[model samples]
Target: MTVPDYPRPPFKPQQQSFPGKTDKMDPRPDHGEDSYVGHGLLAGKKALITGGDSGIGAAVAIAFAREGADVAIVHLPTEEKDAQRILELVKKAGVDGVALACDISDPELAAKTVESVAERFGRIDVLVNNAAYQKYYESMEEITLEEWTKHFNTNVHAPFNLVRLALPHMQEGASVINTASVQSKKPSPNILPYAATKGAIANMTVGLAGLLAEKKIRVNAVLPGPIWTPFIPAGMAPEEVETFGEQTPFKRPGQPVELASAYVMLAADTSSYTSGALLTVSGGAATL
Candidate 1:
C-alpha cells in the first residue's frame, strides 16, 4: 500500500451529523473488507470492542474475527445499521459475532454491556476501548460544561469503567487496548476537551499497565494520527474535511485498514512482552 493508492487531501468536501455512517463517505472508508488476511494468531480468543460500528474500531473488529476470535461489538442504538454491517463481516470470518446497542457513557449501561459480552463469550480475552466522542469548538468559551462532561464521560470514564467491569472475566495473557490519539501528545486547541481526554487516556494506559503487570494482563494504547474516518466528516467543518491529512508526511489520511495490524499484534500472544506501550500509527506525523 503506497501513499498514492490511498485517498489524499483536497478531497471532495462533505459533512455529516455526529457518528456518521460509512455508506455516506465519499471514498467509503475501508475496514479491511478484502485486504486483511488473518493467521489464526488469536484463534479461540474472545474479544470485546467498543464503537465497533465503524472507523478504527470496525477495522479492528474485522481483523480480530479473521484471526479466529469470537467478537462482540458495542455501539450506540443510533449506530445499529453500521453495527449490523460489521457483524455480518465478522460472522463471515467463521467466528461468533455479537453486537450490543449501548451508550457506554452511562457507567451502569456500560457495566451491563460488558457483562452480556462476558456471558456470551464465556470470558473476555481482549478488550478494545476504541469508542470516542468529540465536537469542534472555536474557543474555550464555546465549550459548555455539559459538553465538557460528555467528553470525559464518553472517552475517559467509559473506558475506565469497561476495564473495571471486564477485569473479572479477564485472565493472565488477556489484553486491553485503548484508542488514544496523536492529539493526546500534540493537541489542537479547537478540540481541547477531546484532546484532554486523550491525554488522560494515554496517562491511564501507562498506569494501568503497571497495575496490571502483577496480574499478567497487558495494557496498552494505540495513538492514531489523522485518519480518514467518519469522525472527520462528523466532527469537523466541510472545509477542514477537504484538506484532512494534508499536513501529514504521507499527504493523505490513513485508511482504517491501515491500523488493523497494530491492534492484532497487541492482542496476539506473540506480544506477551509488550505492555504499557503507546503504539503510534500516524502517517509519519510526530506525536511528541
Candidate 2:
C-alpha cells in the first residue's frame, strides 16, 4: 500500500478534553492502518505495551503484531474504543492482542498488570513503556503539587513498577523500550513537570540498561519530537496545536507509524548488541 504524504499542517484548530479520542480528530492520526509492511522481524515474541490504546503505542502494537508477536496492551477503561481498534488491527497480523484496562500509575496495579500478561503469555519478550500524561500550564505555579505528583507517578514510577515485576519473567533476549521525548533534552517551560518526568525516563533507561546487561536484557528508549496524535489535541492549547510540528526541520509532525520501525528494530534480534541507546525519531529536531 502506498503511504500517505506526511501532513504539512495548517491543521484546523481543535481541542479535546483530556485523554482525547482518536475518532474525534479532524484528520485522523494514522497508526499504519494502511501503510506499514512488516518482515517477521519479531516473530513469535510475547509483548506488552502501555498506552497501546492510541498514538505511538497503538502503532507499535500493530507493527509488533505484523512482525508476528502476540501483544497485550494496558490502557484506561475510558479508552476502550481506541484499544478495541488497535487490537482489531493486531488480529489482522494473525496474532492475539489483548487490552487490559487499569491505571498504571498505581504501583500495585502496575505490578499486577505485568504479572497478568506474563502469566498469559508464559513470558514477556518485549516491554514498551509508552504511556504518559501531560497538559500545558502557564507557569510553574500553575502546576499544582497534585498534578506534579501525578505526572511523576504516571510517567516515571509506573515504568519502574512494571519493570520490577516483569524482570523476573523476562529472560535473555528480552527488551524494554521506554518512550522518552525530545522534551527530555529540550525542556518546555509550559509543560515543566512533564518534561522533568521525561528527563527521568531517559536517565532511567540508561541506568537500567547497565543494571540489566548482566542478564542480557536490552533496555533502550525512543525520544520522539512533536508527533501528530490525540495527545496534542488533549494536552496543548489550540494555537499551539495549529502549528504543532512546524518548528521541526521537517516542517511536519511525525505520524505514529513513522516511529514503529525504530521500535521494531529495537525489539528484534537485530538490536541485540544495542542497549543504553536513545533512538530519536524527532523529525530532525536536535536533542541534547
Candidate 3:
C-alpha cells in the first residue's frame, strides 16, 4: 500500500521517558475527560494499568474511572507530572486512583506491583499491560545485547509477571489487555527488539486466552499505531517527533482519547464474548 502524506500539527510539550507526559504536551492530548459519558458501565470494578501515567494508558485510566471503576496506575518512578495528573484525572471522574512508582522491569517489583493493586482494590477485574520501551539504532548490527534485554524485560516479561501475580486475585469475568504495537505487523527499520517483543505479546495473548478459558477470564491485545505520545518525543529526534504518524492513512496522529472507547468497550460487559482477539487501532496500518 502507498502510505499517504499525513499532516503535522502545531508543536506541544512532550516527555522524554516511557509513556511520556500528557499535561504538558503541546495542544495536550485529547483524553475525552469531558466528552466521555459513563452509564455505570464499570460500576465498582477495579483496573490496574501499567504505564497509566500518560499516553493511551492515561486516557484509558480516565475513561475507566468515568465508567465507575476505581483505578490503580503503576508508572516508572521518575514519571512524576504525568503520574500526578492521571491521579487527578481519575479522581475528577469520581473514582479512586493511586499512582504507584516502580520499575516494572524488575521481576520482584512487578510482582509487588500486582499485589499492591490487589490489596488496594480488594480484587482486580481488569489488567492493562501497556508499558513498553524501545531504542532506535541506525542498523541491525548496531543493536546491543543489553538493549535487546531491556526491550524484552520491559515489554514482554514484565507483563507476564504481572499477569501471573494478578491471576490468583482475578476471578471469572476478569479481563487482561496487553498493549501490543503496530510493529508486530508493520516492520520498522530501527526497532527490531521492540517489534520482536510485540510479536511475543501477540502470541501470548492467544496462548493465554486458550489456557485461561476454563477460568472464564478474557485475554486480548490492542495494537496501537503511531500515536502522539511521549514515546515519540523521548525516543525520536525533535524533527522526527514533529512528523510523527505522518505515514498513516489517517493523515495525522491519533490522540489518546481516540483509544478510550476501545478500552472501555473491552473492559465493560458489552464485550462479554470477546476473547483471544486483537484490537487494532493502527491508523489503518491493517484492517480489523
Weakest lDDT window of 10 consecutive positions for candidate 3: 1-10
lDDT of 2 at 68: 95
- How well is each residue in 1-288 modelled by candidate 2, as lDDT tens digits? 565787788899999987898998868888898888888999999999999999999999999999999999899989998999899999989998899998998877787888899889999999999999999998777999999999999999999888888899999999999999999999988889999999999999999999999999999999999998999999998989988899989998999999999999999999999999988899898878
lDDT of 1 at 36: 86
- Give the alpha carbon lDDT tens digit for every residue of 1-288 in model 3: 233233355454344654455554665566666666677889999999998988888889988998899999999887877789889989988888899998898988888878888888899999999989977677878888998999999899989888898999998999999999778877577778888999899989999999998999999999888887767776665666766776777767888777877888888877889999988896786633
| Model 1 lDDT tens row, 144-226 | 99999999999999999999999999999999999999999999898899999999999999999999999999999999999
How many pairs collide in each candidate, listed in order?
A: 0, 0, 3
Candidate 3, residue 114: lDDT: 83
- For candidate 1, the per-residue lDDT at 168 reads 100
Task: State residue 98's C-alpha deviation in candidate 3, in Å.
Answer: 1.1
Q: How does candidate 1 score on lDDT?
A: 0.94
- Model 3 earns a TM-score of 0.91
> Residue pairs in steric clash, candidate 1?
none
lDDT, each prediction: 0.94, 0.92, 0.83
Q: Report residue 204 deviation for candidate 1 (angstroms).
A: 0.1
Best by lDDT: 1
